[model samples]
Target: MKADPKNVLVGSHYLDGNHACAEGAIAAGCKFFGGYPITPSTEIAERVSRRFPLVGGVFVQMEDELASMGAILGAAWGGVKSMTCTSGPGFSLMMENFGLGIMLETPCVLVNVQRGGPSTGLPTLPGQADMMQARWGSHGDYEVIALAPDSPQESFELVIHAFNLSEKYRMPVLVMTDECVGHMTEKVIIPPAEEIELVERNYTDKKPGEAWPYEDTKNLLSPLLPVGKGYKFHVTGLTHDQRGYPIINDEAQEWNVRRLIDKVTKNVDDIVWLEEKDVEGAEIVVMAYGITSRVVQPAIAKAKKDGIKIGMIKMVTVWPFPEKRVKELADKVKALIMVEMNYGQVFLEMDRCVAGKCQTYFVGHAGGTVHNPEDVYKTIKEAVK
Candidate 1:
């Protein structure tokens, strides 16, 4: 499917990441937005609110983040592409319902413009600390898909990708951007509508009485039946059967949760996105994502200039972490260096994937500002020793 011509901007413009995210959602056929104003992410909501009316879409500002999450879930089930935006505290508040979306197999997008935080640590500052939380913050055993964008242009492009993944897999997807990228202004080219591809919702073609909302399938994905389409089905956050009714027992629990996980785990290769540069025969490799991916460039250049053989891996999809590829690199490289604004969230994943196959080093801090390029260069030098 392609984007609606009415929704696309169709030209180049200087846009901040948040505003670009709003345009991306619009162009991707998102028709409902539910969000509350929060620092570093409010521009997304503000832009959506102003533009939605013109595009015949709906925008609702709910009481809080929890309500915002619920609203988008409802909208998604009503047969519309929906989304919401927030920062760290709001992201934390939405976890329970986020799990609900996962359980009910709701397709929606959630944008978390990450800010420094354990709790409201720095509302206006950038942080990649939420990378771990996006995977595990929601309770129970389920898999998630998350994308991290480094620049405003990517912020525009990746939100569309997030929605496509959510619809394709029938689950909530996340755009884990940060304040630095959210507020950074850059030139973004909005392509023509017919050139922008999208994945339409997988609505069922079965007769009303023949389809169960959670019916078991060979591929493990049940096609969605929109509400008020003469489809009488139930949905809840509990363990459920093929009919979408509560089936509170160990068997039901295993059956229900396992598929939720397997759908993503079994299809990791199709969903995960990574960018590798000059990794072959390199002695050291630097791993980073979000704004930190761009921040580490100077260090990579310096290391290359000094005759150090260093490569780079920029994670485009952060969740369903690129374990296979990282493991492959671990066996080839002499050492791995993980750099981010957070103390060591994703670095832990890298260390585990390396599994002592090679040396692993972490260069990070509790987020306030980005890393100093010289500091990253020094770490690269040390790792090569």
Candidate 2:
């Protein structure tokens, strides 16, 4: 529930982080939510499942993670904006078909409220352990747009952005949250429907002509028509040509894969987004995102007040890794302190991008809870010298 600022009581009341995320999806015009109830992220599904029925939308709790993901994809193909949520193990189970969604160019959202894990590690705790897995878990070199939010309000806003980006790009966008933000209670202000900008999938008819399912357009993302719209086209996991037919030749495989990859890579500038703290003249910079970034913020403010030239970069979108902006930041800063809750996962990516330009270090811990602000401060002080 969110307080509507328009009349001071127009929209729903202030919802928790999980419910705020559900409301964001609904605000973004999501008509279908298919997912299983897993710890930490279960509230999201429960809330959506309960709310959807009232809005004339569909909510189906699938048998497992695999089926949950599959159902979301199917729903998307049926011209419905859809989503699914889960934890680490469930996310792992969904990856095989996650790649399938990539190949099919399905427009949907996957919300993984990550908990501790290698396998059922900690269901009731906060962890950014799956940041790397969010990008690489599905296997193959494909594009994944992962967003990390530091608060309930952000969890609400980012989910809408996730849906917009997914529809605009025609790819599966992941709104990756953690147990801290998912379970934390906060006053989330939901914007009115008129204020929220929504982007629907493009389905146009060029009049009285056969709509090309996979026409040769300059933009790699072609128009998507529906199943019963009398368009003869194919969708498969194998290599597909422009017309959606399977092409077993080397050149065809190269063309399709290259196009899919290039569609995202070429548009990295538009997709890669972040927020920066005081960066100029900073000797030490701490780079963190998601719930962990919130933990490190107070440390940064204290450092700034103490006249320590410490800066920060709070990344909102993780992949295409924000490589160019990160490289620029690395060149200017003396040291980069990457604070994640994993065993050097996304930290490795930061290292690769900032190599030879500046010093890079990691502040990571994983079990149940996250590192505190004082811990991040200690590392920032150590790395400053």
Candidate 3:
């Protein structure tokens, strides 16, 4: 489907990532935004609050992050596209409900403009520390799709993609951007509505009593029935049957969880996105995402200038970990380097996937700032030795 002509800005402009994200959400047909103002990410809410009313959408500044998450979920079930934005502490608060969104198979977007934190570590600084938390924070067995954008341009673009994925798969999708990208100002070209593609909600074709809420389909995805549509269906966060009633049995648990996991794992090829450069015959490859991908370029340039056969992989989709591509590269390259603004969170996944096929190295930072290119260059020089 095409974006609504009423919502798209339809011109080039200099915008920060947060504002661009807000514009993207509006263009993607998101009608409800429930969020609390958090540093770096607050601009997104501010922009949405002002723009939503003009486009016949609703923007609510909820009491807190927990309420913010709950409101979005409720809005989604009520037949509206919804989202919320937060930073580290707020993201932590949203975890339990985030799990609920997964269990209910709610299609919504969560934008985390990350800041350094175990708890309130660096409220206003850049950090990529939430990469692992996005995958595992909610607890229990479930799969999620997460995207990392390096600049304002991608911040605008990927949020739209995130929404498309969420609607197509019937699951919550995440845009794991950081303070650097959220605050960075850059030129973003917003295209006209006709050129921007969107994925509409896959509502069920069956009438109220004809279809079950959690009916098993061949594709492992069931269509959603909007609330207030006289649909007589139930949905709960517990292990549920096809009728959406809680059933506490080993069989039911296995059946319920496996579908949630398989829906994503089985379709990884279609969900994952990566940008690779000079990888064909390179001796070593540097892997990075978000702002770190941009941070490593000078190092890569230096390595190439020294006649080192270096390649790069920019992880556009951070979760589901791109296991196949990493394994293939592990076989071809002498070494793989994982770079991020945190100390070895995602690098652990890269190492596990490499699994002794090739050497794995981590260029990690403690999160107030991005990596120093010289340090990365030194690591690149050392990896070849």
Candidate 2 Cα misplacement greater than 4 A, ranges: 1-12, 207-209
Q: Candidate 3 at residue 35, lDDT?
A: 98
**Would you list the clashing residue pairs of candidate 1?**
none
Record all residue pairs in model 2 with backbone atoms less than 3 Å apart, i.e. clashing: 1-13, 1-14, 1-15, 2-12, 2-13
| Candidate 2 per-residue lDDT over residues 231-301, each given as its tens digit | 75678888888767888999988888887788889889888888887877889888888888888889888
lDDT of 1 by residue, 1-385 (tens): 9999999999999999999999999999899999999998999999999999989899999999999999999999999999999999999999999999999999999999999998989999999999899999998999999999999999999999999999989999999999999999999999999999999899899999999998788777789988998888899898999899999999999999998998899889999999999998899999999999999999999999999999999999989999999999989999999998888988999999999999999999898788899999999999887
| Global Cα lDDT for candidate 1 | 0.94
Cα lDDT over the full model 3: 0.94
Residue 384 lDDT in candidate 3:
98
Question: What TM-score do all the candidates reach, one by one?
Answer: 0.99, 0.94, 0.99
Computed on alpha carbons, the lDDT of every model, listed in order, comes to: 0.94, 0.83, 0.94
Q: What is candidate 3's TM-score against the reference?
A: 0.99
Q: In model 3, where do residues sit more than 4 Å from their true spots?
A: none
Tens-digit per-residue lDDT, 1-385, candidate 3: 9999999999999999999999999999999999999987999999999999889999999999999999999999999999999999999999999999999999999999999987989988999999889999998999989999999999999999999999999999999999999999999999999999999999999988898878899888899988888887899999999899999999999999998999999999999999999988999999999999999999999999999999999999999889999999888999999999998999999999999999999999889898999989999999999
**Where is model 2 poorest over a 10-residue stretch in terms of lDDT?**
1-10
Error of 1 at 294 (Å): 0.3
The clash count of every prediction, one per candidate, is 0, 5, 0
